[model samples]
Target: MATQNLIPLLIILVSAILACVEAQTSDQTSWAKRNETEKEVITTLQFYFHDVVSGPNPTAIRIAQAASTNASSYLFGALWMIDDPLTVGPGPSSKLIGRARGLYGSVGQTDWGLIMALSYVFTDGIYDGSSFSLLGFNPVMKSGREMAVVGGTGLFRLARGYAIANTYQANANGDAIVGYNVTIVTYV
Candidate 1:
């Protein structure tokens, strides 16, 4: 009689534990499904990037370089830390929208290629306080160069996209005005 009673109690305990585990598993699955089913939004933006490598108030400054950097035609192993301005137009005095803050290094031996890791930190309009990260290779001498938008924060959370850059103007001092077109996808 006592064994029978204990068996019922054991069975009830096992069932309760199983139920708890199933509930937890189901809750996690539902959360993932919800995110997966959410709609995605694609947004495109155009802006100008001013990379001021010269003058008194330079935005980009050379931080490090290998000994052979100057001798190499491609500037291999040269790295620069940048806080370049992003604006509405190609001119330096254009209305500021954001900043491209990060670093780029010459990683190519045969070409003028730079490995860029930047954060597009916005400070105006609807995107203020939001920021997206970019990482890719930029061929400086090329007419049109593209980079990947890896991720973001704030309004741009979980963002993925691409950015195209074209040199609008450049001078012998290495200061440049570059135009950018970016397309991004984010969860709605």
Candidate 2:
């Protein structure tokens, strides 16, 4: 009876040991594979972003805002969800390339700053079906704003880099066209 109990315990112990060994071996194998097959590639891309907030067919819309958001000079606490178009040029009629879809909120009280969480999904050329994530602060009032490129999918897998945005045009209604220069490093 005691031997039967010991048998189960021994089986459990052996199984746990095997699992641990397998996990270690798997980790080592993956590390080796990554070292052998992965090569770091840096790519730079330029594009234009169109943010239309007030038009018949707007691409960006104000989803939420705080009670005092309108009272602030910087429109603090205003949150927007956007699906803006990315084009080859600043003009609306420029060649469509991708879309910038995500959320951004005014987080600055004394300045026009936004906390943006966005993904640039490419739909043209070699990058078709690939997308990279951007998450960082955007000081809109500045001449150039830099944001981090955190991660990506498809061809941009394991991507990390930065994006520089410069406002090309802005109107009274808050619609704007911005130019983006992004540099990213990805493991291929």
Candidate 3:
């Protein structure tokens, strides 16, 4: 009788152990790597955000492996379609910003984030009267629509709310942008 009771208890213990082990194993993709196209896109986007969000003189590569998530793959792709998609920095300043302003400012990857980041930096990444006026004047008001109209990318549909929130803020005139996610465009 004791042996039979022990057998059942042992089975239960084994089953519980298996459950715990399985829980520890997740089957998600490692998106931070640059082996594939999508991962590379994410890598570039992360660097851009870290760079111009600071200034023309940022001198650090503080972005980590898990910068963005797998879910943001589409936004990264959209960025690739429009921008240079190069990793040109980790130097004294972010070369990604420099190249865009250098030779490809007109037809390069000018995502709403980049535009707003430019506005944000010009304003010293802080919103005062002079700063607010600059961002408000030539901001990305119909940015999503303009991007779609020009290239017809669906990033605007994929990440609209984030774009609006990141790309603009409220002032007496309207919203001001401290920073914007140039990659994500809006539909309506």
Alpha-carbon TM-score of each model against the true structure: 0.84, 0.84, 0.22
lDDT of each: 0.94, 0.95, 0.28
What does candidate 1's lDDT look like per residue over 2-79, in tens digits? 999999899999999999999999999999999999999998999999999888999999999999999998889999
Q: For candidate 1, list the clashing residue pairs, or say none.
A: none
50 Cα displacement, candidate 3 (Å): 30
Q: Provide backbone clash counts, one per model.
A: 0, 0, 10
**Better model by lDDT: candidate 1 vs candidate 3:** 1
Candidate 1 vs candidate 3, TM-score winner: 1
How far in Å is the alpha carbon of 40 misplaced in model 1? 0.7
Q: What is the lDDT of residue 108 in candidate 3?
A: 17
lDDT of 3: 0.28
* Pairs with backbone N, CA or C atoms under 3 Å apart (clashes), candidate 3: 82-109, 83-109, 111-182, 112-182, 113-180, 113-181, 113-182, 156-185, 169-175, 169-176
Q: What's the lDDT of the predicted structure labeled candidate 2?
A: 0.95
Better of 2 and 3 by TM-score: 2
In terms of TM-score, how similar is model 1 to the real structure?
0.84
Which has the higher lDDT value, candidate number 2 or candidate number 3? 2
Maximum-lDDT candidate? 2
lDDT of 2 by residue, 126-157 (tens): 99999999999999989779999999999999
